[model samples]
Target: MKSILRLAAATVCAFTLLALQAVTAQQVQIEGSVNLTPFEARGITLSTLYKVDGEFAGKQGIAVPAPFTLAAPRRDGQQILAQAKPAGGGPIKIYFATDDPQKRIFSSLQIIPFTMKTDDPQKRLEIGDYFAIDLLKKLGENRTTRVNLRRQVTVGGLPAAEVVGNFVNAEGDQLLVRLVAVAKPGSPHGIIGIAVGHPRQGRIKKVEDIYDTSASLAFDTVTFN
Candidate 1:
């Protein structure tokens, strides 16, 4: 009877351990610092464009090129266009926007090829997340004031992360920035989508609404090719 009781107790313990392990596996894991200073110090810039294509086709007349397709919303009574630029030796960076400074909203897509030394999915995600933040900083041309959101998300059926924050541009104009980083297991590249805007009120609800619509559209509509 003693041996039988011990076996039953062990069985319950084993099941409990398995349940805990399953829960942990389901949680999103972020493997790197969320700070932006280190990345900024690297002096990465997306300013120069090696290629420019004015032809925008499909919904709202703006479509991003291969590896992924992003359909960004049009604003400010202007025709939206997708622009392409080289990211040094990395994959080309493609973006969509109008030149209306008053509207102050744009979205961009970038694909970064993975190196053998950092090929793990988690590692790729970490790098992708930082890259997304860097894109936001450069696009806004602002210094980050505060980070409001940093959480796990899914984009295009792939594991991803979203970072939203407040920034101040050179002229002291407040801005809102949102970025999503996505990585597919076993794939050789990670993708990042960035959205930037200038908020009139800067309220939390306003920020959420703008990001939920604009930033969400930038990443949620992604189609992998």
Candidate 2:
């Protein structure tokens, strides 16, 4: 009788283990695939375009993925300014709020094109700092410190640099930024992907997604000049 009872307990444990395995398998299946889009500049391709599981929108030179819906595409001189928002939602106009609704506030992704030879960390920071200056100028404000920097990182197998930090504008509103500079070896021109987050308490979560998405960005096709 003791032997039979021991055998029954063993059977129960086996079934429980199988049930846990099944749950784990289901979770792995639900996590979606990584999807990326391509971007081009100056008749040459650059490794500075990417995203996950989203559709692309915007007309003309400004092309970006969804959840980043653009109101319209306009070029401010050589720079392209596209007012973007999440789909199925209105413009993210609220600056600082405490909920998901406010989190969708209007944000923009600014792409700047330039040519550089090296992929050094300090050089990348300088480039990123220059971008911050341009961004602040666009907002008609200045002064940003507390920069978070990363270096020697690869974006789609190409060397890249990333900087994330915040700055207070003229209105005393804080704006978070995640900017990545991607450089492909032997290419004269490189591209920078900047996603500026709305100044709010819970904006970090979404801003992180944008940063992660951009890390996988690369040109779909490359052409040499």
C-alpha lDDT score of every prediction, in listed order? 0.44, 0.35
Task: Give a tens-digit lDDT track for model 2, residues 1-225.
Answer: 334324322311221100000011112111112223243232323222222113322321233221221111111121111222322121221111122322233344444444443445556445544543443334323344346554445555555666666556555656666556554355434445555555343434543543422211222121212
- Off-target runs (Cα >4 Å) in candidate 2 are 1-106, 117-144, 205-225
**Each candidate: RMSD:** 18.8, 24.1
Question: Per-prediction TM-score, please?
Answer: 0.52, 0.41
Q: How many clashing residue pairs appear in each of the predictions shown?
A: 0, 3
Clashes of 1: 0
Residue-wise C-alpha lDDT for candidate 1, range 75-151, written one tens digit per residue: 33332333233322223333333355432234333333322224556655665555555544454334445677887
